[model samples]
Target: MTRPLRLHYAPDNASLCVRLALEELGLAYDSVLVDRRAKAQKSSAYLAMNPNGLIPVLEIPQGPMFETGAILLWLSDTYGGLMPAPDDPARAHAVQWLFWLANTLHPTARMLFYPDQYCDGDAEGLRRTTRQRLSHQLGLLEQASHADWIDADGASAQGCYLGPLLRWFALYGGATDWFALQRWPRLLAFAERAELQSAARKAASAEGLGPKPFSAPIHCHPPEGSAV
Candidate 1:
């Protein structure tokens, strides 16, 4: 067998998606932790790998893979599982959600939680605006989640898959409530299942390495959206 892949990641940020994807794919990979709080991501060594200094860099046999969503697509395609079979409608559906998580939901969520980190403008003003935007997008997320999708219990449900965001919301407070999440048991169940996976739990444990105060914490529209 070939040697395992090498993965450098920071668990406290959006890198969790790639971590979970690797686990689901049963890929053997080594982990390198980046200290987000210390701004280690901006270091020259890391910048050489990814100018953006983002986490969850996968050093595949062919080359380095950056960006979580892109990595997810590559892993699913390269390994063949966790997503719908190639060209299936569900495959498109999976990519739809993945990109929504990547482009719209994830960016919005980060802006809300860490506006100060990204912006040097009025921090309080950014926080207020971010909260409002977050609330509105969350409303959209609840609505879409309640429509229809695969559920945790293997039953059909209209709105589900908001479980990951619900957990984050529950930890942070504000946003919506638990009833909305329960509307899709399988989605919640899926989150729970994925959460319990060894790699995911391990990643969670690694988050503690960030500064002591590092508690971690998205949205869509008239066109409908998902949170990261």
Candidate 2:
């Protein structure tokens, strides 16, 4: 850990999740903008780092890492404190929710935001179905029997992940009219609380997200790159 980690990011993209975790962990790192406005993620340099050509790629001592969830989990496990310790009673529940967000909620968001990538026809229909599914998924989170994984100070990597997903749900997916965080009181409450975390505050300032980025999102006016 002699050198700081390097994070390749777009201003308000999924990299924000990794950014939030790094801030919370108090790790100093450098950021390289991917310049989505220029399709920089698809460039040869970036593709070499990640064949999938996604927005975030964390350059660590081991090598360049892709996938937001894997980066978050690695930071948590490598540095600790971002989740319940591996042997703790709460650890299993903590990891489960992290995977659910990554595996379930996140892919659904991708389908909604970039429908063309998921299909060649009926893109609108895909979004229509996805919106309904997103609602039901949020409802499951709202009604989950336990949220100790995320409840304390937006402390886990999952909270960092959820906060951005919440923002994107209202801001992306074509017609956001069907979505409202207020409909799920607990999640809305989580957004309200998550915004107050020091890490979230730093992210807002760095990415031109307003003070209420999570609880009440507006389209980002990033200092450097485009969100889309």
In lDDT terms, which candidate is top?
2
- Candidate 1 lDDT by residue in tens digits, 1-228: 566787776543455566656665677788776766667778998787788877758888877778877877787778876566676766666667667767876676667556678789876677667666666665565456423343433211111123334445434423333224445444444555544445545544544421111112222111111121
Off by over 4 Å in 2: none
Candidate 2 per-residue lDDT, tens place, 62-150, comes to 98999999999999999997888888888888889998999999999999999999999999999999999999999999999767754
What lDDT does each candidate get?
A: 0.55, 0.91
The local distance difference test score of model 2 is 0.91
Candidate 1 achieves a global lDDT of 0.55
The C-alpha TM-scores of every prediction are 0.70, 0.97
